[model samples]
Target: MARWEPHARQRLADAALELFAERGYEETTVLDIARRAGLAKSTFFRHFQDKRGVLFAEDAPAGPLVAAIAAAPAQAGPLDAVEYGLDALGRDVFTADRRPFTLRRRAVIEAHPDLREREALKEAGLTAAMGRAIAGRGVPGLAARVTAELGGLALKAAYERWSDPAGTEDFGDIARQTLDEIRSAVAEVRG
Candidate 1:
């Protein structure tokens, strides 16, 4: 297959997952992944920087995620717009196609303290980006950050529920319940 084919990155992702599972994430090399996908090393490099790159796995959609939130109906509340962004992330970033690698990928991330630290930083970056997007929609500062934080937490909770084998609930349902909990908690604290 051509390296520049439309499905090439997906092919690479699949190969990386397989190799990560078979050899353990640390043992898997980018070359091994590319070779597994029946492509050259350049093809793997073209799709990702290295084996760890598969963990991030999102080559696109960054701009669009922020842009969608920024471009949401002006009348929408800040948290509502953030919810829209989180919903898009739920559907796109953490979907079934990517979940197959979750166990090993998360394991790799967990085992390395630095990787987990980086994950935290990434989450902060995502929140700040969402906050900026909300602020762009005319929402103010702390309010925007607060809304973004709740959105991120809602997404996190929804993902946790999604990861459960007994989790019969839908992502949207989980998000609603999680956010409602946050609302309740905040109200209780104020009271």
Candidate 2:
């Protein structure tokens, strides 16, 4: 049996990312990550199911996004509610200090097809959860689904821009701007 180690999860994640970047994802083994983190292999299993899980375990829950949406003003439109969720993500998850790690993680995922597929599935799950949250606010199903999809697009775009080494804007600000751009594009398409 393995006992809980302080900061074990974060240590393992950092070590895994470093290993993935250095040795390539396919070449990095779970035992290697455990050794890098100075934790027993059981500790790695305690935190994540596998090596790929190390990158994604922290985001396994959509709770923060859904909570932010639920906390939005009652009068807010579906997209506005979704924006609130994105803002929360910026404030809580994708802070400026995490940008470097995010860039490395994105690169690792992009380099591997399996990880890319998992990332896509994760995004789809997140969007589905967001749509459900919107519908809970009394939005129509179609409208909720549309808002969720648009929000997903905005999130991806904002993340890309924010991850740029030269970008200095906060994640929340970039996300709001990206959502606005998405809205404008949709309106133009409707014309």
Best-performing candidate as measured by TM-score: 2
User: Which clashing pairs does model 1 show?
Assistant: none
lDDT tens digits, residue span 1-191, model 1: 56356677877888887776676777888778878888888877887876767777553435656976877788877767766665676566656655555545666677677678877777777777777888788877888888888876776667676666555555656666777787788788876
Per candidate, the number of residue pairs that clash is 0, 0
Identify the runs in model 2 with alpha carbons over 4 angstroms from their true place: 1-5
lDDT, candidate 2, at 58 = 65
lDDT of 2 by residue, 6-104 (tens): 889888999999999998999999999999988999888988998878778766348888999999999998999989999999888888888877888
TM-score of 1: 0.80
Candidates' C-alpha lDDT: 0.71, 0.88
lDDT of 1 at 163: 65
